[model samples]
Target: MDEKNHIITSPVMGTFYRSSAPGKAALVEEGQAITPSDIVCMIESMKIFTELRCEHPGIVKRFLVENEDPVMKNQALIEIEIH
Candidate 1:
């Protein structure tokens, strides 16, 4: 089987968060296995936080945006190697 690269994009324009809160373990990390229902990250807009879920099953290759970085809608946030 061949593995394909999949880009996970931000669904909304907001600040990206790797963890639920500061000083907390990251929700997901590089090289972590992820499922379609997995919460990959969080985005905060106007003080409202939204959980960003994975749409594909794969291994997290890397994060395109750093934590607390502002991202635009449809901006690539993570690179995943599809299972």
Candidate 2:
């Protein structure tokens, strides 16, 4: 939670997915460099999946929630070290 780090949060109440689908490689990994338009993860609610994009340029520090974990609106999801 450093000032230079950006915390990404869940946009809605749903289940979080690290990849586009089961058995696929994750969209991002820890220490990966990401752009504002990068799809970091996906959130599924009501059987609909929504891709969550990065809003700042940074290196992904870690994921706060595990795959398929239920998340609430505005809940912390990922921590990124601003680059």
Candidate 3:
């Protein structure tokens, strides 16, 4: 059977951060396994930081945005292939 891929999206408009802080490793990297409760990234809006989680267990396929990139609500952030 073909592998099913899922797209993880942003829930709010904000600045997308791949790492917790500058000069740090990203929370999730491409091809990394992730769980539903995993904190994949963070979105900062209005001076508040919000942790974004993966809704399904899968392997991260690709990142749609770069670190510190501005993102809009509902924008695709990452592609995950379901396990």
Candidate 1 structure quality by residue, lDDT tens digits, 37-78: 888899998899999877779899999999999999999998
In model 3, state the lDDT of residue 69. 95
Cα lDDT of candidate 1 equals 0.90
True-structure RMSD for candidate 3: 2.3
TM-scores of the candidates in the order shown: 0.89, 0.94, 0.89
As a TM-score, model 2 comes out at 0.94
- lDDT (tens digit, per residue) of candidate 2 on 1-83: 66898888988899999999999999999999999999999999999999988788999999999998999999999999998
Candidate rank order under lDDT: 2, 1, 3
- Ranked by lDDT, the better of candidates 1 and 2 is 2
How well does candidate 2 score on lDDT at residue 25? Answer: 98
Query: Cα miss at 61, model 2 (Å)?
Result: 0.2
Candidate 1 stretches with Cα past 4 Å from truth are 1-3
Off by over 4 Å in 3: 1-3
Estimate every model's Cα lDDT from 0 to 1: 0.90, 0.93, 0.88
Q: Worst ten-residue run, lDDT, model 1?
A: 1-10
